[model samples]
Target chain A: MTDPRLLPRTIAVLGCGGLGVPAAWTLALDGRYPLVLIDDDCVELSNLHRQVLYATAEVGQPKAPALARALLEVAPQLQVEVRQGRLGPANAAALLQGCDAVLEGTDDAVSKFAVNDWAVGAPAGVQRVASIAAAIGRRGQWMVVRSAGPCYRCLFEEPPQPESLATCQIAGVLGPAVGQVGALAARSLLRVLAGEADSADGALVRLQARGLLRTPVAAAAACRCQARGDGAADSEPWGQHV
Target chain B: MFERDPKQLFDRYGRQLLVQGVQFEGQQVLHRLAVVVGCDGSPLAQAAGQVAARYLVGAGVGRAVVPQGGGTLLQQLDPLLQLAELPSEAQPPVVQLWFAARAYGASADVVWTDLSPQGPRQVRAGALQWWVGGPAPLTDAVALGAAVADLVVADALGVEPLPSLAVLDFSDPLAPRTRKHAAAAGPPLALPADPGSPLQELASKLSETLQIQQIVAAESARCYPAEACGLVVADADGQLVALAVANLQDHWHSQDPEAFSRSARTAFALDERAIAAQQRLGRRLVAIWHSHCDVGADFSAADVSGAYPNGEALYPGVAHWVVSVRRGCVAEQRVFGLEGGQLCYADVAVSGELAGRSGVEGRC
Candidate 1:
């Protein structure tokens, strides 16, 4: 059981759409620490359903502020910080500093990679303990970056080719499906926040309608992502987390 | 037990939950849940929607919201609650299913949905392995969704999502059972990535030319199961050439079966013939390349130790590249080297010749 009062878990949500909304909603409603919502987009007619934090009348309003307003109404005691902007290299470290975890809900390959690069690249010697969770399509995946595990870059160092990428416009996803992913991502992040040492370290868990699968991932030996090269040189590669 | 009660409808399931030692405030916990699922026309999603809603609704959950995704709206779905596809600058097949979040902070949100077919049925992201290909009838979205719902309801009411994954395969006689898989027994895969290196310039040149990547991809594919070994060198005309070398793991595995049960799949040893091959080609071994058929493209501890067996680079001024071959296809290709007592990787432009040209055409 994670006693929110004692842990003081603060989360920095990178986006406020489908995934971000539920994550924020759940965290705020749970009254768990301060919530920071970052996004430049606004609410629109099309976003009414899945982005649960906003209402119909709130359409055309900026999302970060709108979400903060909506969440505050439900969780007045909780602090909802809104950064009405996108996450770029310049502001990422600043916005992310001191946060316990980052929930990645961005819609493109570029931003996702940028977030991972920045998260793992947090100034050297500064133990970057932020865990990441994502709800893409119908799947929920998450990993914790630590000295003993793999970073987001270890799994995907490069972004997918532009033409190869899929968006909601192209490949439609169910509304509640993203919601499910959001919930799953939130749960995984909570586990990370709780310091659940019993949970597999750096193991990625994928959740779907039917079941969830977990696979252990390790940092590449020569990975440059500031996550490696600080220990005894283990002599083997495939099965052990290097 | 009331005969006509909704709890009766879930008598057997409820008993199963009880048997699993799920703690709750009796039935009040289930009734307090507010679940919202993302629904679409897909049979899997649609089926999953019905099953999950029924379980929560039947259990007396506060409300179960199913938002029809895509541009289309559900005909009779309460328009007030039907979820809409989020519109933003960048659109991707992202569906947000925030089940049980409506009560706000008063409740814990739980999600139960099927795998989306938008991306690879199976995806490997970081240390996470997400595979969606499951056997039919038993693992369909609807049945699985119900199991997940059971787990969530039980959990919100204060229970653990059982069986690690919390799957419900009603199609099976067991009705609800957790998935169990023996842990992959062996050492984990070692793959080092992007560290600053002096060989990066050379690595960039090789990668730009597609010489190293293409050859590594092709050889890794050519030699399945067993690790593939090769050397990348340039001809007099500056054309890159790749020579195949025997993995020799078969011999090593036989020598020490228990010590190296997975040697053929896990370890790799370059042949001594590499010296002769380099001399014949009149080219220095610019890079030592191998394939990881079972693991990813990163230098293993064995790789690092093998490179600097006696605490030094065996082939000075040369780089090492590893090809990650999954299911007989080249999944990733990375290059690495030892610089200043540290092992680091260099950027290999995978988009170069390695990606565009046919492996057969690039041979030699």
Candidate 2:
């Protein structure tokens, strides 16, 4: 039997775009956890390709509520909480306070790192693990982060300047590229929630143009995730504690 | 962007146009190609097919040949993506994406003909297999479908060379592996055939196997440290009865360990004379049941070879049941049979009562 504490009761999805749509749908199909959808952006005609939830009718609508209504149509009995708000440093903690796990699919790199920091520094009472994913053109990458393994910052060091990176809009992302990354993100979070985090953590999974590559990620010497704070004891509930 | 309808194309595919290789030339190429997404109507395959189709259409592909009457949402996906029931017989460059359900999980294959000016030469193809455990078929479908779509879009746009095969092994939920093998002399890509299942026909009679289950479990526990073998046959009255046969694995191993490397504890071999005698008595052989000392009730590769040598079934309709004996007690039992020329399994739970005394064992 799985430990009740190990199972996530509530999951918070940080983006309702290409990645968030499929991730939330997969989680909703699992029917084990109630989802909290968060995104302030509105649907657009261009998003219909990659983001499976929205149609042309819902193009001008806010993403979170529209996605919630779409998921409800698939599973009328599903419990879906919608939050039409972007997750930034100001509201990241409050928006994700009760969520046991976070699936971050937002296109913003800074926001991805912010979610990572918040999850790594979360208080002991709150169980938090973040799966951050991004894709551009024909390639994508995703990673699972928790207290026990290398966090997002440990692998990438720091978020690149917004000017340095080509946004999905600028470089253009294939629908399947981003969708696969989102599905993998959801798979990673589900693994962490099931108390099977060894494979999910400590690695960066890249869906390259050639093939899928999973490379081990080492924690930086000065990385904040290396600090054995109150989060270190989190291994107890996950059955990883020595 | 074409000078005739730049605004409309820009409105829908402006983002993808900004991509490196897919600038203006690739977009024109995509618009001329037709992709066919095939599904076998299983819930998992259809869902995956829709996912792949949506990606191809979204990338501004000119036309899509998909299964008709199911993709109402796909029609709403894009107006430029002409949904067709069949591609024209003309020599247009076409890509094929096939979603199939296997015994373990599911598989997707993408085959595209590169019709350059030279000619439609050898077709380039790639395959993706997602092997999953548990009831998370939806997640695997999403991942598998999206991966297939990536292969099509990337190959169409000339982004990079595609790997011959990619396998996602989620059988071990704790540690899933993503293996990408280099191109080799693999079997040619073909449409997946829907083969008839003999396993389902055999499994329908599970309720009548209660007495036979008890006998097999008892015989298995008593024959611990050496594999127990038997044949389920009908008597003169056409009633099912268990006939325990001595496993020749131990005898052969003792005589020639080098020739028969595995011990009797792990392997089982039947005596041809005992089987011939049973056939001579005019008994109908139904199944062959054996025990695995300390493993789960799974039809392993060796079990398949022992039953079907060189892809030929020893007995055409004989069902194979594997009993798992953990610590000298029958833990569980499962039925193994053929499906699509592959070994598949059906699980059965048995409340086995461990017996002590040894029973009659037929020898050569």
Candidate 3:
């Protein structure tokens, strides 16, 4: 009963690490659209446990290209591309131009918020973006941000102090925990593409430790991103001229 | 008849018995006299001889004699055993005097005395009534009151004198007191439900798409020797409602096992066709599902790098789904989305038939 074409017009994965590799593989294997896999680092031995994308033999290999090749082999019909470079402020717009939605999986909160702001300032077609802060330790939190919703900055307000933020390399993470949050992110994007249209415009979903696994719960109010008077009327190059 | 010295009689029973008597104005009348013996003494032999003399005097066979030492002393030892010897009329009746002494030391000294005088005169006149009354009921009541007061003080100080006793008193009759205390403590506060604000929803949506892509790589693990792949589409709430097959053909043929390589051109064409078909249906292909077979659910290095180029060339915002089925059952299913340009996992939620609370209440 829903229009299927309303799914992502363009999709991009910005990191290919413990969390990113699995995400990119899922998208490409789905063979849904032009899927982009990007990561500047190479696969390391220390990443094998949580990052399911690389194996022992693949150590020291470029992660982006490795993930792309593996995805194509599985789904020969998928349109997959790889960019072996770091994602930062300078190239953020160019990489995100045609992307209808983006998944922010970088460990840094600063980078995540930067993605959120870019998604908001980009054209309408490029506005939808989501991030997964999958678990701090054995547990993880998954959140989805849309261009229409409050950006990451709206919920967190400010990034945590550098000393407080823990990266996967430093703090360690449970592989399954990352998998669980990542799976939730994929589902949210699919829903967005379906145009369920409501206040999905400015909503966020948080997963908490309810019992055995984390349970998803919704926030009570709209985000500050949506609260800002940045009217939806802004025109950008990526906006669809419907 | 023979006369016996009083000192000799005293010597035989003095150690085992107490002799009590009264001297009236320097005259010895032997009146109000009693002989008390230890509980282990032989008092029965002494009582028999005294009864014979009394019986002889009362039956008109008067002046019948008995050994001097046994005369009154023996009769005082046990009166009930000698009662049958008295005549119906004119019987010089037998009497018994018993003295119970409370002594603290081993010596024959009496600290207190309890007396029972057995005779018709004492019973008929009701003169011994005081001896039969024991301690009064009022004394028992006082003892009980003191015990209850001690318990109350102990409970207030939380210093239970007897642990089991306190438990019994506190819980035995009923738990009314504890219940009252618990009620005054109050209940804990509850947290608000459904905190997914609008901003979180969008973030969750974008994250879910990436998760779907991850699931695709997971599924491909089922066909390790070969390659298995599928696609998925989801609703606005990030629920996978539909799925399709992506690659149904072989993209590689190797004659040399050591030099085997993936047929990149053939794979690209197949992947493109699958993406095109999903687009034609007006549905956004949220993810591509695949299997890894025996090799396990992890993405290979080739898989990671391969995803970037193929992903950017087709869809930029879409994610991937991988379902890994091992030996017929699903071992794992994951999703992948883009974090910057790198492939990372995205979280997802599978929708069920349960109606949303707001929807069921018709609030929207």
Candidate 4:
């Protein structure tokens, strides 16, 4: 007999690609929250398997709008807004303002690090912020970063090297892998909105397996997002200036 | 066919085996040699001769003289013939004779016999063939005989001898033997019959149980000025398997605006504990139930846009149920699933004491 009214909270999904789309959809559908679908990319055929929000017909369409449309069709009452742009330093500040929680689902290292820095630098009162780093190919790791705990930048000081970056185009990804991680992200977000602020804050959950059906591993102490509360200037940003 | 060791063959042949000067036809002599080595004189004997030739070529002595023969007698004559026919070149001719023993009938026991001057004399005997040749013909002949005797003794004692040269039998090339194995069958597995699916059953049970909890919360809303909350555990299919009511005495609520904020904060803390308790029971926190007395029996904008501390929306599910209590009767009860951040009505059907109240209802 938990409070039903405690459910619908504002959730923002950043990076509406393979991992982002399903997460946004689940949150909008399950948590019944108004979602902000964020991404700058257009739908590509390669994304068909993992990014379930888009159909073959929607290929070449902008991912944010297409995902919003798909989610609306499934759950017509959802307040799905599309932010058709990339999440970078340029708009990271304004975009993250007043958001109940922001999910960083971008695939790029720069974007990930940028989101991490932004979340940490934002005001302390901003309750929750989550980011998902999904690995590509037969096996992958999904890392969730939460706000009010540790920001993404607190964990890894620098962005991953170009050689280590795996893109959906080059390595290939399983659709269900993205789905599982996205579902986990949605579930974590729901729990956060439902007032399990401590569990949802600055937590990194990893789902590593071939199929999207496998369970994820949530790291207890891995979150650097929560450590942002110390407000110590001694901490390095990106481990280096730029 | 005798299997010959190419290293010993290279040592025996040294330099006398011709590769460039001798061409039997239009083809390069080495290519012709490769063809000759490819022949199947006898399966085992040809294998041995090929091994010997390959070893000699690999060792930089690019040519070898292959002799077709039987036991130790042929092995003895091979190097002698090679020395007699030694080519006149820049240096003394070092020739190696490879023995091919195809004519040694069924009783033919010896295949390859090594006759190198630097190492022990050894013979590969039995249905096996021997390759015996070296730079010094006399020494090679003597070693060949000793190797044959040793091979015979070893064979009688059931000790295995290594082959030195590979012999090729070029009789019928198309009839190669193939090996096969039978596949094993796996054991059968038992599966339980589906009374529908467990998930569906759980979902129905959960729906029913939540409906009852909703009724109680509605009654509490009528009696109290503040919102009411409860907790329940459902099985995999969403059936209400267990239920727990939060202690209202330990809880906080307020009628005033200033105190409302504090009450909301305290209620949030209790909500967290309830969620944790449900998780400990090994059940998903399927539904969160709360009452909205005069606020209407539908989700508020604040509720819809509210995010969990982790940033997930509150009612991200198939439905969010709201129960309104008016006076003494349940005035309005609605179930909703969010569609694009707006509340959409969901149908609910309950059994037992609430059987008559089951049907599609609008989001109040």
Each prediction's number of clashing residue pairs:
56, 0, 183, 104
TM-score of chain B of each: 0.44, 0.50, 0.30, 0.32
Model 2's chain B yields a TM-score of 0.50
Off by over 4 Å in 3: A1-5, A124-127, A197-204, A208-242, B1-364
In model 1, the Cα lDDT at residue A166 comes to 62
lDDT of 1 by residue, B1-364 (tens): 2222555334322422332233445344444334455443444445444445544443334334343342122211222222333323112222123211100000111322223456542211111111121222211332234344544544444433322222222122212223422113211222233334456666667667655556667677676766888887877876777778888887878998887666767778778687676878687677888888634455665787777677689888778887765555554566787665556565454543343232334331
Q: Compared with the true structure, what per-residue lDDT tens digits does model 2 show for residues B25-135?
A: 677777777778776567788778877776777776777775556456666666455667654532467777778664346667777776778785456667776755322
Clashing pairs in 2: none
Q: Flag regions of model 1 displaced more than 4 Å.
A: A1-9, A146-148, A198-201, A220-242, B1-364
Q: What is the TM-score of chain A alone in each candidate?
A: 0.80, 0.91, 0.80, 0.77
lDDT head-to-head 2 vs 3, winner:
2
Span of 10 residues, lowest total lDDT, candidate 3 chain B: B123-132
Range of the 10 consecutive residues with the lowest summed lDDT in candidate 4 chain B? B181-190
Candidate 2 docking: what grade?
acceptable
Best by DockQ: 2
Query: What DockQ was computed for model 1?
Result: 0.01
Model 1 C-alpha lDDT per residue in residues A186-229, reported as the tens digit of each score:
54455445654413245666655445566766545545564343
Error of 2 at B70 (Å): 1.9
Candidate 2, residues A1-242, lDDT tens digits: the string is 45664577688999999899878877876667889999989988778768866766777889999999877876688888988777776888788867868899998987898788877776765557888888888678888877555778777877798899988778887777888889888887876777664355657887775556777777634465533346745654343333
Writing each residue's lDDT as its tens digit, candidate 3 over B138-236 gives 111111111222222122122222111110011111110111111112211111112253323433553355454334333333333345666666545
* Backbone-clash count (model 4): 104
Docking class of 3: incorrect
Order the candidates by lDDT, highest first. 2, 1, 4, 3
* Model 4 chain A weakest 10-residue run by lDDT: A233-242
